[model samples]
Target: MNIKEKYEMSKKEYEKWGLDVDKILEELSRVKISIHCWQGDDVTGFEKTQNALSGGIAATGNYPGKARNGEELRKDLDKALSLIPGKHKVNLHAIYAETDGEVVERDQLKPEHFKKWVDWAKKNGLGLDFNPTIFSHPKAADGLTLSSPNKEIRDFWIRHCMASRSIGEYFGRELGQTCLTNIWIPDGYKDVPSDRMGPRKRLKESLDEIFSQKIDKKYNLDCVESKVFGLGAEAYTVGSSEFYISYAARNNIMSLMDTGHYHPTEVVSDKLSAMLLFNDKVALHVSRPVRWDSDHVILFDDEIKELSKEIVRNNALGRVIIGLDFFDASINRIAAWTIGSRNMIKSLLSAMLTPNDKLKELQDTGNFTERLALMEEFKTYPMGDIWNYYCEKNNVPVAEKWLDNVKDYERTELSKRS
Candidate 1:
C-alpha cells in the first residue's frame, strides 16, 4: 500500500477515538524544538585556546570530522536540519563565539562575536537559544563556578552569565523570536561537604549580582538548570532541584529540567504538571541517560512517551521550551541529531494520537480496568503509518532511510575534514 493510503487507513482508526488526524499532524509540524550546537563539536567550542572538558561533563570517543570551527558547525547543522522533520531552532553555548583568532574572555563577550550565527539563523529562518558555558574553563577547574568560594571566580562567572543574557537578547531581537538563555553551573563536592550552606549562600548572591540589571524578558527568557549530582560532585550539589525551583519561583524566571539530571527513579514527566501550575513557563533539555547523567541520544521509549504525553495532554506545548541536550562522539554526529530529533517528534505525535480525554474520563469515573485496558490496547495502534506520512509530507527521509544520507555526507563531507 502507498504511504498516503496507509495514513488514510490509520486516520480512520484514530478518528474513531475522537482524534483529528489532520489537525494533529499540522500541530506537530508547527512544534519547533531547539537543537544544541555542542553536539556537532562534541562540546568543544571554537575558542582560540580551548580547555579540557570538566565539571562532570565529558564527551567520549575521538570521532573524526568534528566541527573544527563555526563555519563547519553551521554547515553540519544545515545538513542535519534538512534530514529532520518540522521547523526547529539552534541552541548555542557561550564557547561557540567567533573571535577572529583573538583572545575573548567569557566575561567580556558581546553579541557581535556571534554575528555569523545570527546571520546564518536569519537566512535559514531558525530561532537561536543561548547557554552560559560554566564548565570547561580554568576558573571552574574545581567544579565550582557560580557557587565558588573565591570572590574573583564568582564575580568572573557572574559577568559571563550577564554577558550571555545580553547575547540571548540580541539573538531574540535579530531572529524576532524569544531566545532562551539557560544557566547550568557545575558546582558541588565529590565527597561529603563540610559547609553546603556557604556555597548555596554565595550562589544566591552571585545570581543576584548578575541579574541586577534587567533586560526585557520579551526578547530573552532567562532560566536556571539544576543537577542532583555530577561526575565529580556525587555527595552533594550546590544547585539542587530544590534550590533552583525555589529561586525560580521567587525571581520569576523559568526553571530548566534536564531529563538526565535527577535520580534514577525520579522521572521528569511527573514534574511537568506541578511546574506548570506554579510557573508561567518552563524549559526542558530532552536527553537519555544510561544510569547517571550519561547523555546518550534520546530514544522514543516509555519515559519519553510519558513525557510527551504530559506536555500534549496538559496543553502546555506553548508553555514548554523544548531543546535537545546530548553529545555522543562514538557514531556519526549528523545521524545522532537526525535520529534523536525524529524520535522526539515521533513521541509527541504518539502522545497527540492517544485518546487522552477518554482516559481522563475513565479515571474520573473510577473505571480503572477500562483505563488500563484501553491504554495498553492503543500501544499497537498504527502510529508508524502516521509517522511515515508526516516525514514524507515534510520532505525528509522516512524511517531508517535517513541513515543513508548521513553515510553519504560522512564520505563526502566529514571524511574530508582533514
Candidate 2:
C-alpha cells in the first residue's frame, strides 16, 4: 500500500478500537493528580538483591543528581504544584528510603531538605503528607521476618525500626504533618512451614517499642500496609481484610489499604469499603494488575472503571491520594512521568464526575450488571475540561497555554505524517 493508504488503514484500525477521546478528556477533568518522584527518577545505579541481607541500598526510583542541591529540587516541586488545579491539590509521596540509605544520611537527621519541601508547599499553597516504610538491613537482605531465627538479623531490624521512628518524629516536628508510615515487612513463609506466628509476634514487638517512645500525639500512628502476598515468607502481613483492619485499630494504628496489593481473587469494591470504613485517608498505590508483575504503571481507567463509581457513592473523594508506584526502567523517565500523571488524573476524573444518584440507583435497585455497565460512561470522561472547571471555580489561571501546547504538538505530528 502507498504511504497515504497505510496511514488511512492505521487510522481505520484506530477508529475501530472505539476509544473515545472526549470521554478520556472528561475523565481527566474529575480530579487533580500529583506523582511520587521515586517512580519518575533516573536510577543510574539500582541494586535489587544482596543474598543473606534483609535489604540492600534502594537505588531504584531515586532522582538523578541533576539538580545542584535540595533548594533546586524544592523550587521545581513548587512550580509543579502551582500548575495543578487549586480546588483539588495534589501531594507527593516521599522516596521510601530504606535502612542505611542516603535519606538517613550518617545518623544525623539533616531534615533541612524536608523543611525546604514544606516551604515549597507553603509557597505554592499546597499541603504535604508522609508515607514512611521501614527498611530491612542489607545484612539480612534475605529477609527481616520477625520469624528469622537469627538474633543478629533481629537486632538489625530493631535498629532500623528505631531509625524509622526517629525520622517520623523529625517529620512531625518539622513539617507539622503526621509521619504516615506504611509498615510492609518483607517477611513471610518462603520455603517450608517457618514459624509464621513467631514472625508476627516479633514484628509487633518492634512496632510497640517504637510507639512506646514519648513522641508527640501529632505524629499519627503508623499505618501497617499488610499485603496478602509479597517477596517472601516474611513479606505476608495481614491475610484478610477483617484481620488487617482489626489489627491496625487494635494496636491504635491506621491501616493503609493498597488497592493493587490484594490477591486478584477478591472483589475491588469490598476492599474499597474496608478502606473507606477504617483509614482516615485512603493511601493506595496505583498500578496495572498484570498476571505476574503488578506493573506499577498508572492504573488504566479500564481497570478501576466500575469500582470507582462505588467509591464515589461512598463519597471518599477527599480521603484519597493517587500514588504512582512503578519501576519504569523500561521507558523514558519524562514520558513515563507524563503518562503516569495523566492516567492517574484521568482515573480520578472518571470517579469525580460519576453521578451519585446514578450510583445510588444501581445499589438501591439491586442491578449489579447495570451498575457495571453505567461505569462505561466514565471511561472517557473529559479531563482537560475539568481543569478549566476547577480553575473557574477557584479563580486560578486556566491552563489554556498548556492545553494549546499539547494540541499544537499533536497538530505538528499529524502534519508531518500527512
Candidate 3:
C-alpha cells in the first residue's frame, strides 16, 4: 500500500491504545539531537600541529573521502543534515577552531577563532554546542590531563578549559541558545596506581579553578563527563562516574553520561531515569559500545528505545540534553552521520508512539503477563509507515531513499576531496 494509506492504518492501530499519532509527530519535531562534527573528519581537528588519536579513543579506517578542513566538514554536514529530518545543533570540539593558519595555543583560544562556525550556524538557523578537547594532544601524552601530578600540566589544561567556557558563552550570545560546554578528560594510569587519591584531589582543584569564573547560566551551561576506563588508562580513570555524579550534584552543573564511557554491563537507559529523578538536568552522549568502550554508530536497537522511553515516561524530555558522539572512518563519513542521526530520531519516535501509560499501569497493577505481551506485540507495530510519512512531511527522503542522496554526494563532492 502507499505511505499515506499505511500511515492511516497504523494511526488507527495506535489510536486503539488512546494514542495521538499527530501529536506525537508534533512533539518529535521539537526535540533536537546535537550532531557531532568530528564524525565528518574522524576527530582530526583543524589544529596546525595535529597529534595522533589518544586518550583511549581511536577512529579506525582510512576512508577515502574524509573532510580535511573546516569548510569541507561543514559542507559534508550540510548534506547529512539535509537528509536527516528536522533542524538540530552541531557539536564542535576545541580543536576545530579556525585560526587562519596561525598556531594559536589551546589555552589562549578565543571566540574569534570560531566566528565562521557561528556565522554558518546563524545562516542555517541551527544551534551550536561546544566540547573542550582534552585528548590527542602533546600535554596529554602520558594520558594524564587535569589529574596530572605535574603542576604545570594541570594548570595548562585548566586554562584551556576556562578558555573553552568563554567560547561557549560566545556561541550562546550569538545563536540565542544556551551553549552546553562539556569537559571530558582522559587522565588515568595504564596500570594500578598507588596514589589514586592524589590524582582525584588534583582533578578536583583543577575543576574548581576552571569553574571559578562566574559565567552567566543564560549564556553558557557547564557540564562534566566521566568514564569507567580507557585504553591507556585501563586500571583507573580519574573522572570516574562516581566523581562527576557527586561533583555535578554538589556544584549544580549538568552531568554528562556517554553510553560508551561506561562499563560493559551498565546501560545508559536505566541511568537516565535515575538521573532525572535526582538532578534537575542531565546531558547524554548517545553512542554504541562494541565489546568495550569502542565508539560505534548508534542504532535503533532495544536499548535506545528503552532510553527514549525513560525520557518520555518520566516527563524528563525537557530536562535532558541529547547529543550524538560516535566517529567511524571506515565507510562514507556522510553516510555514517546519516545512519546514526536517522536512527536516533527514529528511536525517539518509536518511543513516543508507544503506549507507555498503558504498559506502566499494567506493571503497577501486577499484570506482568499482559505487560510483557503488549510490550512484545508493540514491537511489531507499523512504525515504518508513520516514519515514512514523517519524512515525506519533513521534505526528506523516505526509507532507504535517503542513502541515494549520500551516494550522489560521494561521487560529486566527497570523491573530489584528498
Candidate 4:
C-alpha cells in the first residue's frame, strides 16, 4: 500500500493505544535541529592558518569535496538541508567568518565579518547559532585558552569570546531568533597539575569578563560547555562537567552537554531531567563517540533513543536546543550530514510515538508487569510507516531513496571541486 494508506492504518492502530499519531507528527515537524557548519568542511573553517586542530578534537580523513571556503560550505549545507525535513538552524564557529581576504584576528572580529552568513541564512529562512573558536590557533599552541595562566593569552581569548557574543546578538537581531553562543575551551594539562584550582580560577575570571557586557537575552543566549578530558590534556581539564554545571546554575546561564564529552560509561540521557529542573534551558551537541571524543557520525543506537525519550517524556522539547556536532571526512560528507540528521529525527519521532503517560501511570501504580509488557510491545509498532509518511509530507524522499540525490550531487557538484 501507499504511504498515505499505511499511515491511515497506523493512525488507527496508535489510536487504539490512546496515542495520537497526528499530534506526534505535528510536534516532531516543528523541532529545529541546528546543523553544525563544521561538518560540511570537516571542521576546517575559512581562516587562513597553518595550525592543526588542537584541544582534544580532530576531524580525521582527507575526503575530497570538503568545503574549502564559506561559499562552498554554504552550498553544501543547502544541498544537505534539501534532503532533511524540518525548519532547522545553522551553527557557526568564529573561524568561518568571511573577511574578504583581509587578516582579522579572532579578537578583532565584529558583526560585519559575518554579514554574508546572515544574508545567506535570511535567504534560506534559517536561524543561526554561534561558537567561539578557542582552539586551532597560534595562541592555543600551549594547549590553553581562557584558563591560560599567562595574562596576555587569557585576555586575548576573553576578547574573542566577547566579540563572539556580539556577533551572536547581531545574528539573532537579523534573523529574528535567539542565537546560542556556546563557549568550549581546550585548556588543560597533559600531565597531573600541581595546582588544579589555579586554572579553574583563571577560567572563571575569563568567563566573568566575557559575560560582563550583557546583551539582551531576547536576541542572544549564552552557554558554557565542559569536557571531562581531551586528547592531549588527558590528565586534567579545567572546564569539567561539575565546574560548568555549577557555574551555569549560579550565573543563570545555559550549560551545553556534548554526548562525547563525558566518560564512555556515562550517558547524557540520564542527566537531562535533572538539568531541566534547575536551568531555564539547556543546549546539546549530539554526536557519537567511538572511544573518546572522536566526533563520529550519529547512529540509531540505544543511547540516542533513550536521550530523545528523556527529552520528549520530560516535555522539555521547547526548553532543549538540539544541534548536531560531528565530522567524519572518511565517508561522503553530504551523506554523513543526511544520515546523522535523519537518524536524529527518527529518534525523536520514536520518542514522541511512545505512550509515556500510560507507562508512567502503570509505574506510578506499581503495575510493573504491565509496564514491562507494554514497553516491549511498543518495539513492534508500525514506526517505519509513520516515518515514511513524515518524509512524504515534508516533500523528501522515503527511506534510502534520498541517497540517490546525494550520489547525484557528489558526481555533478562535489566531483568538480578540484
My TM-score estimates for the predictions, one after another, are 0.99, 0.67, 0.99, 0.99
lDDT of 2 by residue, 73-139 (tens): 3533333333444323323332323233243432233344356555655555544445433343354
Q: Each prediction's Cα lDDT score?
A: 0.94, 0.49, 0.92, 0.92
State the lDDT of candidate 3 residue by residue for 233-259, as single tens digits.
Answer: 999999999999999998899999999
RMSD of each: 0.8, 9.3, 0.8, 0.9
Residue pairs with clashing backbones, model 4: none
Candidate 1 residue pairs in clash (backbone atoms < 3 Å): none
lDDT of 1 by residue, 1-418 (tens): 9999999999999999889999999999889999999889999998888899998987988778999999999999999999999889999999999999999999999999999999999999999999999999899998888998899999999999999999999999999999999999999999999998999999999988878868878899999999999988999999999999999898988899999999999999999999999988989999999998989999889999999999999998899999999999997899889989889999999999999999999999999999999999999999999999999999999888998899899999999997
How does candidate 2 score on lDDT?
Answer: 0.49
User: Residue-wise lDDT of candidate 4 within 273-360, one digit each (tens)?
Assistant: 9999888798999999998889999999999999999999999999999999999999989999999999999999998888999999
Give residue 326's lDDT in candidate 3 (0 to 100): 94
